[model samples]
Every structure is written in C-alpha cells, then in structure tokens.
Target: MTDGMTYRERARTAAHPTGRVASSPVVRHALGRAHGAVPDPVTVFDDETPAVANLDPELLRALRRAATDAADDGVEFFVNGGWRSPEYQEQLLRGAVSKYGSEEEAARWVATPETSAHVLGDAVDIGRLDARAWLSEHGARYGLCQIYRNEPWHYELRPDAVENGCPPMYPDPSHDPRMRR
Candidate 1:
C-alpha cells in the first residue's frame, strides 16, 4: 500500500469528513470550481463527444497513452462516465434499485455513493462495444483492469497489473466485500 494506506482508506479520506464531497464548497474550490478555473484537465476525443475529466492524475495519463495506442489499432476509447459527484452516484444507485427491483440486484450495478470508485475518481465506465473489447484484451498493458465480471465496461487503474496482470474479477459489486455496508 502507498503511504501505509490501502486504496479504500485513501478514497474514504479523500471525501469530506461528513462523507459528502459534492456539498463541500472548500473541496469544490480546491477542485477548481470557485474561481472558474479548469477543475481538471479533460481529454476530448472529438468535438462531438464530451470530455473525460477528474480522473486520478496518473490514471488519466495512462488512459490517454492507452487510447493513443488503441487508436493505432483502429479502435478508439470512449469514456461513458468518470469522477461522478456523490449525489450523482446516489441518483444512479436509486435508479438502479428501481430498475433492478431490489437492493441486492442494484448493488450489482451501482455502488453506494460514498463508497463508489467513481466518487473517488478511481474508476471509469467506457462506452462502445469495440472499445470495451479492445480494453479487455489490452488494458493490462496500461495498468487498467476490469474489476467486476458483470460490468464489462467498468475499469480501474491497477498499476501492479502492468507486471502481474489484474487480480481476479469479483463476481459483481454485491460479491465484493468492499460493497458491504
């Protein structure tokens, strides 16, 4: 672990003491909202697509390099979602429950907002079947890994994966002990 803290611990500490980053103006300002400064540099694939922003800095660099490599092979990575606000993640979880009809089923699709990797800027959801397939085959080279067996589009940075490959995928968020609350 870096700095004697596990990734989860670091993530938890990254949020406000109240466990809500979205409502913390100090955090928002530090993230560059107060002065209208760029919060985080975004990577825009094209004018037609929204940019991907607020990712972990190292992860963002690796992703851009990976995307460049993928482009050479005629596949382009498209980010569907990244670095969600806590409230946005909560909204997603609520929607997931409504669609899936149970908390258990919803957990498979959406994490609790406070504990979500997205809220911690550590996870991303990719769009496009071809991009996902390409990543499934080559993402380890860039230190990216699919963390859940059921969520093929979801990925996270796992720097060790570059040398050892990714750890085994969890069956789903429900099966992940980290999701237990």
Candidate 2:
C-alpha cells in the first residue's frame, strides 16, 4: 500500500524543487566545466538537464535490455532517477539541517553527495505496485535495488544488490535521543 511521496512523508517540510532554474543560460555555461557561476544557489537533480542528467550509454543499453526482459515477463518498470550534483545535494542537506539539526542527523534520512550512487550516473530507482510484483522478483536481473533504511522509493546498484544496487538531500540522524533509535 504505497502512496505517492512516500519519502516526502518523512520530511516535515518540502525539499526545494530541482528544475527551478530549468534551462537557464548560467547552467549551460558551466556544465561539464569544473568551475563556473550558477544562476541559482540550488544544485539541480538528475534529469534536470538533458545533457548533464543523461546516463552512460552502455549502462542504459543494459537497462533497456533488462526492461525488455521484464516486459516480456509482464512487468512494467522504468528508470526513475539519474544524476545529481553536489550543490543540489548540499541544498537538500541544508533543508534537512533546517528541519533536523546536524550533518550527521541528515544521513539517517538522506545520503551525502560523496557517497551517493546517483552522482556516479549509473544508479536508478525502479518500482512497481502491481500484484504480480515484477520488480521484487525481476529487478535484480537489471541491476537495481532499494537503498537506505528510510526511503523505499530510493534505489541503486551495489555489487551486492544490483541484479545488482539522492542528492545527499535530507538531514543526517541527530545526536539527540529523540531523533535516534
């Protein structure tokens, strides 16, 4: 019984949107380059820009093949997430800190950019709510798996989990007893 925004339910406030500055000239100037000024302070998430958010062609090919296999087996799935930037992740962490408390407090809910699989441009989240439960039975054949203890909607490819396995959005766990298990 999953509802929309399953992960959004954990956060007390809304995270800043990713495409707020979609197609801004400032982003174009700096993309692929190591350094440049950005029009907005927020980092864009994967798929924010067609070029920056694209997946590796080889990986995409495998994903398509797996998807085709699943479809033949009567399962419906799609790659739902792609690349994310450090700046965007920082913005998310800031939001989490605003709601939670410290950087460590954020990790419990969101990942840190350094550790995120999304930044690597290979991980993706795929899920199905159908009763046949195709994803549960077949997604590994494609190299995707859910990540984190809190967000089921999040998935990635770990050598162990993908057929396999965020921005570092959200706050880490808090030192306060009230925030931790």
Candidate 3:
C-alpha cells in the first residue's frame, strides 16, 4: 500500500520525468513539499522595465508590447505568475481543490500539472483591474489571448490573433479538453 519514495518524491515522479525534475534544483528546492522555500515572485514587468525571465521568451515580446500599450492607456499590467514547475502546479491544484471543495469545481479553475500551459512556460496570470479590462479589448492585437472566460487574468500568445483575432474563449479550464488528463 506504499511506495518506498516519500510523498515529495512520489509527487515529483508523477508530475514529470524524474531525470528532468532532478536537473532543475531551483525548481526542486523551490517547489518540493519538504521544507520547500517559495521563491520570490520574478518581476516580468514593472513601471520602469519590461523584463520577462524564466517564462516563455517568445510570448514575452508580444506581452511587453501589449503591456506598454496598456500603460499608454493609463492601465498598468502586472504579471502575477508565469512558468511554474509541475510540482508547483500540482501544489496549486491541491490548494484550489481544497478551497473549492470538489475536484469538478476545482477543475474549472485549475488544470492538472501535466496539462498546464504554465508548466510549459506558455501562459501568464496578469493582475490589475484596469489592465485586465484593457487587455480584453486590445490584447488580440499583440497575439495575447484570454483562453478562459472565467479566468480573465490568464492569457497566452496566439500568433494568429494578431491578424485574425483570438478565437472564442472556453467557458473555463474544465471546458477545455486539453485539461482532461
């Protein structure tokens, strides 16, 4: 009824390839459950600078452009999350499930670590009421698309959107078939 590995080891193994997880000591040290230290939030963008490290570099350029435009319109964009490790993602899922009190309800907000776009370094969670509102109107011009109607804060780069505009949003993460694992 028990594997030899500790809970942290089991969670890590189930979340991603063991060797891959082992190689990222920063991720392990920051995301592992055993005495893990939550790393300081990286500043991907701020009033003075537009920097995007440890996130999807391809998406950053477009995001920076959009953020700049939003600023010009008196809306400040802030990145609250990006490029989470699978372990960190699993932790988030557990927290969401606990708060929502059901797997089905939690699935509407969070994806399994294996299916998470953040785990792949391709998604971002933005903050600021004005920013989210502005992005909703103009983000498609920069290829930034809000994938979930429920999570107005979440956005991903969709190159085609620069010309064609973002496709209609899914109602929530649960409605996205990619989240079914």
Candidate 4:
C-alpha cells in the first residue's frame, strides 16, 4: 500500500479515462496538504500552510485574535482541518459514507463538496481538547462559533456573535439548512 501505485492504478481504472495520476488518493492527499490540508497541527498564526492561510479573512482574523488570547491562558489553538479543496471534501464525504454504511448516516458528519463550509474557507476544525474548550467558552467574543453540537471542534465565523453571542448550534451537518443544498 505504501508503494503508492495501487491507489494510482485504482484511481485511473475506476475514474480517469486518461490514466491521470492526480485522481489517486496519495497524490490528492499530498496536493491537499500543499493547498489546505492540515497534515500536522498548526496554529492560527501559521501562515505558511494553506489550511490556515486560505481561511476567510474575517474568520482568520477572529481565529488569530482568539488564538492570541488563548495563548496567554496557556491554551494554544491548533487547526486540525481548514479550507479544504472541493476534491478533499468529496473524499471526506465518500469516506464517511463508507464508514457509516450509508449516505444518510454520513450526512450527519460530512457535507457534500458543494455545501461544505470548509471548501468555502468559512470553517475550521480546531485541534486539542484544551483549545476547543477555551474556544467554546470565549469564542463568541471573537465571532467564532461552533456550528454543530455534534462537532465541538468545528468552528465558523459569525460576526453577529461578537455582539449577540452565537446562535443555537445545529444538531449536526444533516440538521443544518445550508447542507441541504
């Protein structure tokens, strides 16, 4: 499996007509990491990784502000995921479907590429329990709100939250109106 050609051959045979290597998961994952995948935990201050760098400017600013304050409290904010490519989002959805045994169940955890906030660069999945807990407590002040009750690590920008606090969370992605599209 580590040889990489298995994925490439499968991808070519199953999907690509031109024997393209880009469709391979190994290649896609590498390209994803180059573009926006968080292969390793990275702080909001990490500008080199596209995962952090590609976030919506407003969301990025809010995250950085929150991260700076969190650092003072001895809680460092690390991004587990952010700003996924459409292909990456599709891959995640497919994985979820495989793991959950049905698209209906998968929708609870993963959104379609067209509807994914990560693909839109509007959401981020934070790493570390301490960071998530800190964000849960004080993120509203910075306009970062956890979007799904089931996904405490998933945060999105909600500028109104800065003044009025975050709106109620969706039970999961399946419950969100935006995901219906």
Return the number of clashes found in candidate 2: 19
User: What are the per-residue Cα lDDT tens digits for candidate 3 across 9-100?
Assistant: 33333233221221221221133322221243322342111112444655766776665555556665667777666777788899999999
State the lDDT of candidate 2 residue by residue for 1-181, as single tens digits.
Answer: 0334322221211221321222223232224422211233211122244323344443444444444455455544433344456565566668887777876666675456566545555545444454125544554554544444355545444334442231122222232232333
For model 2, the run of ten residues with the poorest summed lDDT: 10-19
Candidate structures ordered by TM-score, highest first: 4, 1, 3, 2
Candidates 2 and 3, the one with greater lDDT: 3
Which residue window of length 10 is worst by lDDT in model 4?
A: 19-28
Candidate 4 on 47-77: residue-level lDDT in tens?
A: 5577776777668767777776676677777
- The C-alpha RMSD in Å for every predicted model, in order, reads 12.1, 13.0, 13.4, 13.2
Tens digits of lDDT, candidate 1, 1-181? 4368643343334333342332112221123222121233322232112224466655655666667667667766667676666666787889999999998889988999767887777887887888789889999998999999999988999999999998999989888887765
TM-score of 3: 0.73
TM-score of each: 0.73, 0.50, 0.73, 0.81
Q: Global lDDT of each model?
A: 0.67, 0.42, 0.67, 0.78
After the best TM-score superposition of candidate 4, give how far the Cα of residue 69 lies from its true spot, in angstroms: 0.7
Candidate order by lDDT, decreasing, is 4, 1, 3, 2
List where candidate 4 sits over 4 angstroms from the true fold.
Answer: 1-35
Candidate 3 — which residues are off by over 4 angstroms? 1-43, 46-52
